[model samples]
Target chain A: MSEDKNDSFLSRLKAAERRSGLKTEDDTKESADDKDGQSLATLALRAGTEMISALIVGVCIGWGLDKWLHTRAIFLIIFALLGGGAGVLNVWRLVKPPPV
Target chain B: MAGGSSIDVLGQFELHSVFGGLGDALHFSQSPVYMMLAVVLVLAFLYFGMRPAAVVPGRFQAAAEVCYEFIRNMAIDTIGPEGASFFPFIFTLFFFILAGNYLGLLPFSYTFTSHIAVTFALAMMVFVLTVVVSLKVQGIRFFAHFMPAGASLALAPLLIPIEILSFLSRPVSLSIRLFANMVAGHVMFEIFASFVIMLAGFGVVGDVFAIGPIAINVALVALELLVGVLQAYVFAILTCIYLREAVAH
Candidate 1:
């Protein structure tokens, strides 16, 4: 019974894909590469990476500027902390479910 | 709308004098006016882009659709089936910020996004939503996010603070990412633009010499455009990830 059911389901899927004409790896790749196409999890991970990068850079930039202007690490540490806090908050936000 | 404004972000670009605040204070920033203009521009673009309904979509409609689908897919892919709902917010954010960045690139326009305060606000919104959603879905379990998996209980004290700190830094990171990128790019362009103008101001030889900065400015503009869209995408996707952790954990 299970074998028969599986076969029937596969048959329906094939029939539908057939109407679409093309069924190749290339088509799959094309859809995957669609500009607006990306998985939420993939995006989430990427966002996480970007968040880290942005925070680190912001702090470093502040520090560099402070040094250049002879303000020492004052601005650097301050901006770094602020940026770091924001990063964590953003991560926490990712935990929330978005409204439908 | 901005070209004739009574001193706005546009005016800042033109180096016209800004309004004095209460008691002889000069407000120099054009971030606000141009920011509003950017919002209007985004709405107008979306209106025209999506106005016509066609079975075979036009380029504008298709472009709009692509933006919609991209965010939708990003949400679904990151946060599982549970994340499908947040598509609208993510999509709006992506477009709004993207539009703001792009518009700032226009001649004589001030970039609101170059400011930390503006970028920080946007990031804070995302952070707030992350907390709200996580709490709603996971309730108290949201706190458990910092409890490392399979770690020894003895190490919990040291690890928890780091985890918590890491967690709290998201908005700061998110906002600064956009703010830094925009500011740096704009500054470079501004500097180059000044060079071109100053050089050309020198007359014939300066006109011939203006090509260098102009070329660099064009390249930087292209790069800025790419960064704007990418940063928007990055923000939305990060939002999804936090949501996923909330729901899944």
Candidate 2:
């Protein structure tokens, strides 16, 4: 009885393996085609998010400094411009392909 | 289409206490409840799936192994040979976000990742780890990363702050990407679902028209599923990339 149970378990495992193997092979082929489309979408999203975030950070830093140093709009204006520049730089770096 | 009420799309993200008394007293909201649920589900999957350790492996076991191998390979591929040490961290991070995303797809479940707080915390952890690793590996030289190798001296005043701002924004960008994606997808789902309800109120013809929104919702769900996995993959891969930069000479 125990041996029979073991044999059944082994057969079930084999079946599972075969099923998964077939699924994975098909998945790899489909994903290869899908990768290009997906990466482009991801890149666009990444670029936009990075640029906005960098600008926000720069502005925040500038505003905080202006408040602390009791400067009027001097630091704020400078930092906002710097922040925008940083944001553009971030987008550029993000879209550029990595160095080989 | 006539006199339809405005849909409260953002209302779905409002926080409310779960488990009644206990949750109220502790100020514990649905977000943490779903986060804990995600953690438990991940643990259960790993435990139950690995329980049957057969040579050929059963379906559950195979799934568990595949998850393990996927993260393992990703770490190595992105972070190089040293990636082995960080596999467990990346694995946990990937599955946690994935579970949160998938769980949110259920009828009434809250998506913890939709909250910027949670994603920011996760991103901050990654940022802190990268900083620590860079400092540990490069020591004082880590500061040199603020300035490019061949930059002119005159540009230092302009470039250093820009570089620093970009560096500081990593966590912000990382958190916003996931949070925005989750929020946008969920809001779209809500808007479409509300359309189905609103259209159904118009009678038989309206009910027939409701099919349009329903069909769009079905497609949206499918797209959201793809987005969930893709976001998780992106997060993990980005973490690996950061780690790779940290450890590199």
Candidate whose TM-score is highest: 2
Q: List where candidate 2 sits over 4 angstroms from the true fold.
A: A1-35, B1-4
Off by over 4 Å in 1: A1-100, B1-30, B201-205
lDDT of 1 by residue, B72-168 (tens): 8898999899877877777777777877788788886767777778888988888888889889988898888688799999988755755665666
**Which one is best on DockQ?**
2
TM-score of chain B of 1: 0.82
For residue A38, model 1's alpha carbon misses the true position, in angstroms, by 18
- C-alpha RMSD by candidate, in order: 10.2, 6.1
* Per-residue C-alpha lDDT of model 2 across residues A1-99, encoded as one tens digit per residue: 999999999988878977778546667789988998778877888999999998888889889999999998889898888888888888988878789
Per-residue lDDT for B58-171 in model 2, tens only? 999999999999999999999999999999999999999999999999998899999999999999999999999999999999999989889999999999989888888889
